[model samples]
Target: MADKKNRYNIRDHAATYWENSPKWRRVSMSIAFIAFFYALPFLNNPLVNTPGSDFQSVLFYPVGMYVLMAIGLNIVVGKSGLLDLGYVAFFAIGAYTMAILGTHTALNFWEILPIGIALSMVAGVLLGTPTLRLRGDYLAIVTLGFGEIVRIVAVNIEAIGGPRGIAGIPTPPDLFKAKFTILDPKPYYWVLLTFTLLVIWMVRRMAARRPGRAWDAIRQDDDVAQLMGVNTLKYKVWAFVLGAAVAGAGGVLYASQILSIVPDQFNLNVSILILACVVFGGIGNLWGVILGAALLAFTPERIRFLSQPRILVFGIALVVMMNLRPDGILPKKKREHFDPNWKSVEESGEGEIK
Candidate 1:
């Protein structure tokens, strides 16, 4: 029993187990997990449903949208160790793009989708080009300003409906008889789920390659990484661009589902909430980020009976969780432990051998 307890301590040994498992077994398990999430909306479990909300609708909005945005932010904040307080700028850009084009142009949802993502990438490049050189607090402040600027610009632009925002954004064309309607949020949830899975798959693939190594090196020490020949500026811009792309995709989905949006919808608070999700979950761990976003988004709605005080409760819970797990609920394992007798070295006072 003692041995088992040690093996399954506070750290995530389960992830190690999964990593070491056979590829076929992992593939099968992944398929099963995907199936479960796809069927989640249909479950209609009263136990999991919120009292004052439509569970399906909630799943698409705060829950699904938050998870998607969190994953994107994780790339910039977690993978690259960038402090982006204005991450919501990309979200707003994408959302406004969809709203304006969908309302006035001849483009359909699929057509506008690429345009929104492209425009978001451009926005990211523009922001990173001038500000990537700044580090620490300076970088964070610039990003925060960028987020506010996007919202303020939208509010002043009458062509985009200004503060009132655009309405009548066209929904995605029907798929396999699954009609997209405000009343039935299941289709939207499925669409977002599909995109979420795709992003996860892509991120995992990237995390195993050169970009991942560059990010790790930069995160450990930017100056050292630069001395070692890593193009710090290029990679930082890449992180910003990719992260923006993800947010842009999510925004398009959100606008289509809601059929309307306002400038107030995209604010600094949204960025803070997203960053909170990344921090709450193990920052560098993908699954942990997803879990954090889901829980944080769901908890407030789950306890809606507490009314406005739910925000206070949420804040207290975050404080408590941080105190208990400073590294996050499932902090990423930095290195593998291959040597069974490694602990003996520490005990002998030799410490870790470089």
Candidate 2:
């Protein structure tokens, strides 16, 4: 009876200690971080305009797009280590699909979003199926060419409005049916923020799972991954599909926000900018990519006083990042290993036997 009572006391103490301790502290910190994120648009300095409350909307849009693009690229370049130069192709396809579908049919922005995503998935699979068989620089070149093809088609296709591009895309209406209209972008800001968070969460989940692990192994060495029974082709195609889907979602949101679309909007330069964000942020780190995206998206606008020199500064920033911190702003931590353990395992002739 005494032992049972003592055991109950121990369990109670443990529970009480946890309740009063750092576990709660960590949870509180997480809640604070989330609050901070939601409040960021509301907290603005002089460089960003917030006079009429539109600044919050303006700021959130850029950040949201960058976050979305970074997440998409994270799947391809970060998880799978695919050096794709044509990722913007998926973005263009999504935006254009949303534009055409919404504009041509009576279907509204909300209705067209799912269709846009489907189109992006199909495009991803179509492009990835053929190119996943290639490797290294060859894959990059092929993807680059594919991107150019997409842009060229957008430019030349008359039914899609050709080089002039499509304009007058409708914005998403208030779904809540508020009696009063929301002229301010605050509502849209929240919507985009929610969308961005959802995408980030999804990307993080994928990165923590078997799919992400398989892609990482394939990234390290396709031959070794295949020997380990990882379906290299299956995972590669999935990476492409998932990455394209995210990009497509971004495109739909962006087109709706801007209410305009141009072939130039989905050009080679866009791809480079997104790739720059991914590399600058830390290839394997989602949070790092978010930081990188924010910097890339907002830096020039903040330094508009520099005028044309902003491009020079941007170029310098990239050059310095490569030379000074080649691993990126948030590099992966080096994994520690026991030397004797490695030697013993190696000496066991396990690898040789295989």
Best by TM-score: 1
In terms of lDDT, the poorest run of 10 residues in model 1 is 345-354
List, residue by residue over 12-83, the lDDT tens digit for candidate 1: 677768879999999999899999999988877777898898888889889999999999999999998888
Error of 2 at 59 (Å): 2.2
RMSD of each: 5.3, 9.5
lDDT of 2 by residue, 93-185 (tens): 888987887788788777888888889889989988988888767788888998889999999999999998898777776677622123455
- Candidate 1 lands at a TM-score of 0.91
- Name the candidate that leads on lDDT: 1
Cα deviation of 199 in candidate 2 (Å)? 1.7
